[model samples]
Target: MPRSNWVSRVVGWDRPRREQPAWLHGDRQHLLPTHSHTDRHVVSTIPAAQVTKVALKLRHLVESAVPCDLDESEITRAHSSIITPEVVQAAKEAGGSEYRACVVFCLLICKAWFRQQSVVELWDADLHRGREVACEVIAKKLIETEDDTSFLLHNILLQRYSILVDGEPTYPANAIERAVDLHAVDVITSSGYQKCVDHLWRGWLVQDEDNPTTFVDYANRDKISFFTHLDPDRIRVPRYQNATQLLVTIAFLVLFTVAVNTPNPSGRLDVAEVLLYLFTLGFICNEVTKVYKAGYRILGFWNAVNGVLYTLITASFVLRMVGLGQPLDHGHEDPAHHREFYRTLSYNFLAFSAPLFWCRLLLYLDTFRFFGAMLVVLKVMMKESLIFFALLAVVIVGFLQAFIGLDIVDDMAVDEYGVIIKAMANAVMQSPEFDTFGRFSPPFGTLLYYFFTFIVMVILLNVLIALYNSAYEDIYQNADAEFLALFAHKTLQFVRAPDENVYIPPFNLVEIVLIALFGWWMPAGRFEQLNDAVMSCCYAPVMVAAAAYESNVARAIHRNRARGGSGDDYDDVVDHEWERVACAPETQVDFEAEGWDKVCEAAKSDIEVEPAVQEVRQLRAEVEELKRMLAEISRAVGAAAAGEESK
Candidate 1:
């Protein structure tokens, strides 16, 4: 059936209401175009073959036959050329279907415009606004279609494109990068385009039920709140999930403390030690599952921290086990000493990991506004510090080589490299050890040390400070948007690993065992039922709270609607006030009597007075015109009187 006909049929009331359409329910397999085995993971709804065909058709429509290049001025020409009516028509013809073609064409044009804005200076406000309007229209149409737009938008947001390496047409890596490159974060995150972001969020959250994989939307929610309403069945809400994780983390930390503090001198595992081991194993499994699901993407700073903590705990466990396995002294030199040594080593490793586990609390705490904002700043500053570290490495290497070269006698006094490193580190900390370098090579070594101090302390340290400040200012200046982006990113992390059933930490160990035992032979539906039952049982308390909250919210929504108030009225009002103060004035506005005070106040402000100023200038011009007319009439009268006298 044709796509349009299918849409029409789906909309009609005559059609029997059975299960919702696959597209509507978030199953996109039938909607997405087929791809070759090699390109199976590509999220694009348009076929690869169709992409090439459309590219050819678009190339023919351009006046200049030169190949399109985003880096050069050709991007503007390509954008203009593709949006032309003739080219759009040709693209539609080549697409084998009008609706699909138009959507794909719009995406291609948007991609071009995004690229053009990045490379070219957008001094032309009209041109820029026109392109922006085009993008807005494209986004609007996608939302209206509501069939395959989610998949298409996801393609633009998540997929990377490479022409030379992949033998495909050139395109931006992803919409996010393109927006960032053009310094248009606000445009993408603006309320007018929030539906687009939501669509992208939904796409990221898609979980296939038939063939359940680890990659499932873990943090899917209609609203984000600790006490927000949600369907009873919806246990994967962000706040609830975070709450569960936070509880588990706290439990794990408490267990670790108890286990570490209790004496285990008899080489036997205590209750706390046994429970800690199980929790550690669960956490290890969780990290492994995430790494397997997300691959290299999971190897971030926090994950690295997790890796270190796990390694320490695992080593500690192994050492304890080894010590337990060792035979008694049996008249040997000192069996007690050997066993004590191993025990001490194991405890030391576990004790050292305490700080790391505490720091891990930040991971779950980031859902809060204060922590989320701080995390973003810290993340940015950490990225900035890489440059500082890279330069510092070079300086250290040069200085190390110099100091080593100076130690010609094979000193045999103090560890030469250690002393030099210690001195340099001290200098970086603003406490240079000038006297330490004197023994190496007299005045030359001392002078070199002084120079090193100046370069690192004065230059490199200051540069690092500036980078940190810039990063802090950039994030704080647009704090809300940055936090939203962070929240979205956090939400994405939970869902990136598509687990049909969420098993928080130690619980996941049970899931693994259950899956191993029955998942292979059981029917998918039965397996899902089993998982759902397990989740409900485990998360019964939270689910009950969620159901109660949802019922209340539903009642509130109905009440508001009955009172002739929209559920979103408050949000709309807030958005309107924010836009009035921060955004450019709209061409058309509806003024209400109740809002007259606000309008008057706004008119007095610099941002909202543009229209009023223009009106005032027009009135002044009218007054000048009347004055000129009166003077002309007076001169004419004088001339007529002179003519009469002469006659």
Candidate 2:
């Protein structure tokens, strides 16, 4: 195809582009390859020749539907003396629609070629080259002009260029200014195409694809080699990524029993027992931290239950053998209580982790909301992430207050306070508040738990959703309406809620002063009127004021009205009025309201018209009989002609 005749979807036209000439597409011609492209630019000595050719062709295309006389025989013959199958084949790979919707197809190919600085640098090179070929092949079938829409041009180019997008899938950032420069402002993008582009890009890799077998099938192919042919490398996954495959290979180690009758050490501790204790300690800590981070992501009831149950069973054995590896097992008598406490701790920790994991998943889906929610809650709570000591403190105070009274800490006896730590242990599980004093008495500590949960879930959640909604509302309103709508909306809000100025409750100090000043002490309406009078008096003297404005407007409108008239009723009024003004030399009073009075006299006459075109007033009158009859006669004639033509 001749490049001159092709219409670019990117550089859209100013008029309706005509179709390609019939002769150009009578047969198909293979596109001349890059070897045929000249290394040098076109004719440097007379660049004017190429420019003039372009200018004239464009002018002719805009003005007329017919093809221009200018013709290049070599290009024309090359386009015509070819087979059709190659053309159809090229069109198919571009997409089946490209064959029929050639205007858009040409755009894709042309843009691809031009945008490419190197082989495929422009991002649309493959398609652009194809369009150039099509243009040459169908030179005779080209349209002269087309009205281009800027939005359409940008959307078309974005669609043709890539199949994937992240964030907003908008036209490339500079599209607006580029379009204004080219002046292609009328093209409309077809619908539903944007979603396909989004799917191709901004998609996540699935777990199955991360597996070893899927990896080798997609990533390792014996057929592809660098020297043999070029391939699209940016989209490929690397070999090291397969390390993610190891998540599936886990096996849990169970508790091992030691051999009986083994009494062979300095104090009697076995090496296996020491190693076993160390491993167990490390595992418990690791589990705690991991659960804290990934609680919600593990979605199973039994998994949660298992953590607590296992912690209880393991803690029993751990406390029973507390000093087994070392040489001290004297006063530590309650392994069972320790087991139960650890179990409760594990269950609570799991509960905390579950929420954290859910929050993480939400953040992954919506970064803005997740982060905003996090900031609000943290801003409210002041810290993030679990700290062991703080959690221990909360648990101690909380259960103590629940069972023992909160004030009991204040009234500890000398013996009871002697072992401060042991005293805490007394109500640590069974505090005094846990036992009913009477019908139902409770300490402040019990209320704290309910309040904490309420603050986290309800209050903090609402704050986050509120901020997000505010941001979203702003964006949504901006997208739907222009400045005028915003102005109207704000004006309506202002009118509807005059109190929205904010009813600041009167400060007692300010209220005293205001009451003294406004308690029927001053006339506010009179004060405002006096203020306006003083402001206007600073301008012209009253006589000149009325004269300056009224005299000028009166003369001007009369003059303007005179100009509109064919003959002289207004001209007479203008002369009569001007003479009266000139006749007043000293007093400078407008004389002879005579002309105006006479004009009003003819108010009933058809010649007189309202100075202001109040359309509503005009529409209020019934249609004149003559005008009504004329319209009816016209419609009758039109109907009769249609009936005659049909017969």
Candidate 3:
């Protein structure tokens, strides 16, 4: 069999094969491996109780080794080459649990190799070298496959080039092709294929600069390594994250509320000053951490909103501190009154930050997706409506000038601003006193007012409504992509977790010094120790309580989902066929009748064209009659010639 045919069969590409020219066969010949890969990595001898866990670990190792840019077809071919009869037999002997199947699948992927000639034409020699090293280890049986847990730590040969992945089978069919096949944007990711969607979820791990498993060899051997979360030492559990976020939010609300309520609140006071300063410090540190992780990518819409809020809060804190520093009996105007003015300015700054802070909540609630999308749609509509309002303003100005010129109203009742306002009101048919336009000279002012009102109220209002409707439809059409982008943004936040030494909010001031000045020189071990020592003593109890609160909330959500509650079904905001179906319900469409109606319309069109076709046929018949007359004339001439020949 030809090499291309062999590769096609291995990957199960069902498209019709084209014959390769003799010259192309030289390029194809080297893709075939010279020897079979017989060293199957199996944990059959391991205890059955620990089998699932070990298999899962092995699967993780295999997937983690896969390079980010590896093609689906290439991986498929490699995996297929490793699935020999011996490997299948060994997999069967080891109880075929889902985890075991996943491990066996990944083991095959690891054992899979390409001929050096296969990828020689490509520029990325490093990717091919990694695969070749993996294949060599499998061929040599250098990896310890006997013990379950021990092998994970001991396998040096496998450690260097091991493929890490989400433990699922990623097939070539899962990819959707446009200009190129995009595997990540699959609408419905089957459990098996979910691991392959790098752009959506898995890809972020490799791209994460903070990931401890940056060294492939270290990750393969490190039992505590995780693809999605931070390293074990720096890991912040999801519940802990929830706790921290809740604490910060509550602190912000409490400090701002008290400060706003204080009598002559904008005046300098020492109340909650320490707490307010601490919160501001934490906010700045967190923003810096995000910037470090994402670099130039930190400039998104939500980030900008948070940046403005941070600026306001910081300004308030600084202003309050300056006010406190000023003496009560300064040489200027009344010192106490000057202090009050400065304090008031500080309070104003704090107060203004509140709405922007609340707006940041939209970033978290984006998982619901539709609400976020609706907010975007509404923003677009408002922008379009501005133009309509501008045109309306032009008309209002014209009417205002006319009303003033005609001297149609009492000056006490209406000034220029009042005239414009009342005209606008009249335009929308909201003012009953628009009858006052009648006070103008006979036919002109009344006609003008009525005509202006009809155009502004009826025509322009409808046009604005139509514009909004179109915008809504346009947004709804691409809501899935919009929501995915939102989700990706959220994913990146966790991908760049804050330093382990940063103090938790309510007392995060220490972090400003630790992170801002000394962060680069601080060892990871020392930082973690410092953070653990401080947190365990100062705020451990509060964090524990917060974690417990988070746990209870989670349990409540699960219970609600179990009971089929209305809002509980949105566990994961994934794109699915059911969501599409639910959004657009079947309306009992008469497809059969509709199809017949289409056929009838087609027949009517054919009938309309039939008269011209019939006229052409009649012309062809007349031509045939002329041809018959010519033939008869030729036969008479032949008879006359016969008579001449007889003479």
TM-score winner: 1
Candidate 2, residues 596-626: lDDT per residue as tens digits? 6665666754432333434545664444665
lDDT of each: 0.58, 0.30, 0.46
lDDT of 1 at 116: 53
lDDT for residue 326 in candidate 2, whole number 0-100 = 36
Clashes of each: 7, 43, 13
Candidate 1 C-alpha RMSD relative to the actual structure: 11.3
For model 2 the local lDDT of residue 317 reads 45
Give the top-scoring candidate (lDDT).
Answer: 1
CA RMSD (A), model 3: 22.1
For 1-647, candidate 1 gives per-residue lDDT tens digits of: 11223223122222222221221111111111111121234333444445555544443443232223322232223234334444444434544553243333434444454335534654543444444444433333333433553444444343433222146433223333333333344434544234444433423234344322212333333243444433323555555676678888998999999978976877678898888889989988777754443345336788788899999999999988888876655466876556666777889999999999899989888867889889889889999999999999999889878888877554633465678788889998999999887877677788889889999999999999999999999999978777766665555444333334678888887777766666656776787778778887877777777656545544554555665555432232223555545444653344575687687877774543356687898899999998899999999999999999999
Candidate 1 global lDDT: 0.58
Query: Which stretches of candidate 2 lie above 4 Å from their native place?
Result: 1-249, 252-410, 413-632, 635-647
